[model samples]
Target chain A: MRGRRAFFGFLGKEVRHILRDWQTLLVLIGMPVAQVVLFGYAVRSDIRGINLAIVAPQPDAATASLASRFMDATDTYRVVASVADAASLEPQFRDGRVRQALMLPSGLAGALGRGEPVTIAVVTDGADPNTGSLMEASTLAIVRAWDAGRTGRRAGPRIDVETRMRFNPTLESVNLFVPGLIAYVLTIVSALMTAITIVREKEIGTMEMLLASPLRPYQIVLGKVAPYVALGFLDVVLVLVAARLIFGVPVRGSNALMLAESLLYILTALGMGIVISTSTSTQRVAMMAALAGTMLPTLLLSGFIFPVSAMPWPLQAASNVVPARWFVVITRGVMLKGAGLADLWRETLILAGFTAALFVVGIRRLAVRLA
Target chain B: MKAATREPAGVGSGAAHPATNVGAAVQARGLTKRFGSVLALDHVSFEVAPGELFGFIGPDGAGKTTLFRLLTSLYLPDEGESRVIGHDPATDMWALRRRLGYMPGRFSLYPDLTVIENLQFYASVFDTTVAAQMDTIEPIWRQLAPFAGRRAAALSGGMKQKLALCCALVHSPSILFLDEPTTGVDAVSRREFWDLLARLREGGMTMLVSTPYMDEASRCDRVALMQQGRILRIDRPSAVRAAFPRPLLAVTAAGEGAAVRIGLLAALREHPDAASVWPFGSTLHFTDRRAGPDPARLATELGEWLAARGIAATVRPISATIEDAFMWDMTSAEPAA
Candidate 1:
């Protein structure tokens, strides 16, 4: 009973510390909404309103119909100029007026009637490889459909391949980022914040007094991290609600399961934080370690923004050690695919293993007395 | 005090060795500690009887804080052993921690917490309530009550010390270890703090307090004069003063300005018979090399010697203070730099 009282007392002190620092509290509560909106609106993969230059040396019936087809294919393209040659589009491309240009050879409509092969080029500004490749692919698809329609032959020998995006139809990047945001926000809130709080005590000399007390090191750690667990959970909820209400991201799986998984990941992150605090003696070192050691890995190696399978084999092998990687997988599976435990048990088990390993390491390293 | 009734269990199981010393509040057999290449404490050994107000007097880097940490179980000794209240600090820290209160050298309370909240937090962590231990901390708490709602960081240095002391005492531990409780505090507050310690000692509490102020040594029942990780002397303040080995003189020139004082110190250092000369406050304390000289004869001789140098000075034989004894011991213990 006395031990419980002491633990509660320590917990209350930690909560008061969090509440009193209005700046940290603001960051804790406001960062999630800001990051979600920022990712959803600004960091989009879909393209819109791409300025296109149609350069046809001679305006023939075939060229005009092709230009009209490019314009009418989708809202993604806006024809800024229909010049006679590609040379006139250079100034437009340099001046930010055009991002992609379609060049057509001088031809009569008779060339197509005689079934002569024509060479067409889709020119794109490759300054940004992602947007450039996307524009090139979109232009090629439009030309293929236009050519197939012009041929008016549905009985041609062709091997048609169909592609469908699973879990996130229409390929909304917001659907992908929202689930990943939970992991990112929890890493910051749980690991970084907990490490800072613990190191602050060590910096200010309060850890000496706490160590001199009857409370064990484990008790002190649990009490210090208990408030962060609640705060991390609240952040997870805030991110989820914001994702649902603002981004329209769905929680296809059980909300209870998502929360349970989130709690486990928070504990794992907190364990990582405690381990960091044990190894570091100052708040600056702990903050740097948490950022470089946990946050960077969570963002870069966890498949949050980049797919893990696309990475080099070494990085793919190394990503297995990042706890957030498993968490991101579990969250994406639950939120998008509505995967049950049977489908996600592998990731969940890996996450639990990380939690166990990190916590055991953390507690064992937490010195009961100052060295 | 309530702690008296709750004598720590397993006291008999400790390696007390009652034959040598029974009921010693604190006992250490060559406690030593090192940090990297620096030896913070070197074979420091001492004993404090129960209800004794023991003080460790030293200047900065004297290992006072390190010794306190070792005794409080905040650190383990690199060599040797120590027992507090019949419990070994290294092996039996759990029960030892419950019965002792430690106020570290730095202000360890939460700076953002209100005064009362800090107090209550400490009280609860020890599994007690503030109201239950009110009687023990009432004297200090009464002064702190007016600022109960104020943040600890906003308190003056003296008030911060008082609040730290109140927090350390809130649990009514059987023994209290205070490390440099008065280093940065004002003179008036330092006196009040010592007086509070004196009152606690009268209530039969065992207190081990360390300070850099030599004047505060006179207030302790016994003081250990420490320097460079070693105890130079441990005795009653008066005994330490009485143990001064030289005939000391306080020399002051008539109408002496800072320039004249400097000249007088330089002149005295040149004197063949002058063993040691150091500026103490406004006057200079001088010790002679020869032994067994009549103080009056020495004073007259020194006065004549100064007169011959075209300086009017008063030379009076003065008794040694703890500071004087400390300077003597410190200078004699080390080789000339």
Candidate 2:
């Protein structure tokens, strides 16, 4: 209990410094807002006509009208140029005027009317896979819809599987990002700030005063970690509030479970901060290690933007070791799935185990230094 | 606090008895610390006797702080043994930590906590209370009681130092290690600070303080002059002065320019027995060579030589201080051309 009080005592002091500092406040609050707004509008999964060029070779009124109908349904996207044959599709696609080119053979319409097999070629640029996938999917849906209206049904039986993106029906970008953002902001600011702060004390000569006291070296290390863990929790509160107020992000999971998982995460993050502190001697080096080493991976590989399952196997495996990755999953499962502790008990235990392990490692490093 | 010319055997308070000798309270043999490829300390052997105001005087990068950290168990020496208060620092670090007080150079107390809170934080960690340390830290804490409510970071450098000293003393440790405690403080603060240290040293608390300031060397009972990770000499400041191995002459000119140029150079050439010619201030200092050298004759000959060069300067013999000893060690690190 005295250690708890000592812990809170350290935590309070750390919070005081962070609240009073202006630059850190700016970074913590400003970055999330900017990133959320930037990603929200810039990223989309559906594509329409998308600069379509028809290299039909033989133009028909029906084909031209079909292209017009396709553009009209997909909002703003339209057919930009009409070519005489398949030869023109390559040049138009390569010059970047179109995302894809539609090539229809001379007898394509006749074959479709006669119920004969008709093939249409869709040539695409594969540089951006996500964009390419979206373009291909949307175009196929439009063509299928058009064919269905012409004939009552296709020769082969078709089945529709209605998909609903739970919690985020429209798949809003902010909803997808809210939980990831919380983990990232908390992990980075908490781990980095405390780590650099302790190292800075050593550089300036203040660490000697702490070392001289009856305060065990581990106690000193804890005293430094305690304050930032509280700070990390405070950032979590800010993120939850901001997510709701700014982006309508729902917190569907159990509130207590969220807080508990977050506390475990804070422990791991603070442990990381302590590890970094013991390794570096200057504020500059500590800050670099914290930001470059921790923040970047949390943001990029934690399924914050690109889905981890969708990422290549190596990156997904690499993400497993990052504490932030677990935190993000916990955040999303709770915030979006409304999942209880029972649903995420395995993840929670892993986090608990991780925090304990890192704490032990950090304490051991401090002990070695003291010894 | 005594403002006497000569420091007594005892320090301020809680000092060890005057009977103990070097490293009796703290001892290290074959002590070495390697960080990757660079050796911060190499087989350094030293001791802090009980109740002695021992100082480790060295320039920046002289491994004073590293040695201090090793003594406090903030670092593990790779190849040597260290004992503090008869306890092996590596094995008995926790117990040793509970007995020793360390004051690092910077003001490391909680900047946001009230001065009392910072003291209490440290006290409580050791499982003691502020009431327990009233005797040990009262002399220093009295100065800070008025501003106990203020944050530690907001305090002036001198006040902060006093607060830090109070915090270190509150736990009542037997030995203390202060690493560059006076750095970044003003002159008045530095003098006042050393006075406080002298008072603490009198209490019979063994102290191993490292300082770059040469003036503070005189206030210590004994000093270890260090440079480039090696001890040049360790003795009483007076004794270190006595062992310079050559006579030192001071030269001054009425005109500052002539004193620096003609006087120092003329003195150098006029006496081929000159071991070293260094600019101490406005005038240059000429030290003796092993070959026979005369300060009086050298001054006269140097005066005529400078006159021939159209520069008039005064050259005379002067007392050597620890700074001379320090420069001697600094030059030792460098090879002669």
Task: Choose the strongest candidate by TM-score.
Answer: 1
Q: Write the per-residue lDDT of candidate 1 for residues A1-371, one digit (tens) a residue.
A: 88998998899899899999989899999999999999999887666888999988889988888899878846688998899978877888897899999888777355676666677788998888767765766676667666778854333213231231344534567888888889999999999998899889999999999888898888999999999999999999999999899988999999999999999999999999999999999999999999999999999999998778668999999999999999999999999999889999999999999999999999999989987
Q: Give the DockQ (2 decimals) of all models.
A: 0.70, 0.36
Cα lDDT, all candidates: 0.86, 0.72
Error of 1 at B72 (Å): 1.4
lDDT of 2 by residue, A1-371 (tens): 55664555555555566666768777866765555555544553434448877777767754665576666765625778777766666766787788877666676566566666566677777678867744654565555455666653333113231232334543455776778877787777667877887886677655655554445567677667765676667677777776677667778988888888888888888888888887888899998999877788888898886678778899999988888888887888999989888888888887788788877887777634532
**C-alpha positional error of residue A255 in candidate 1 after TM-score superposition, expressed in Å:** 2.1
For model 1 chain A, the run of ten residues with the poorest summed lDDT: A155-164
* True contacts reproduced, candidate 2: 0.56
Docking class of 2: acceptable
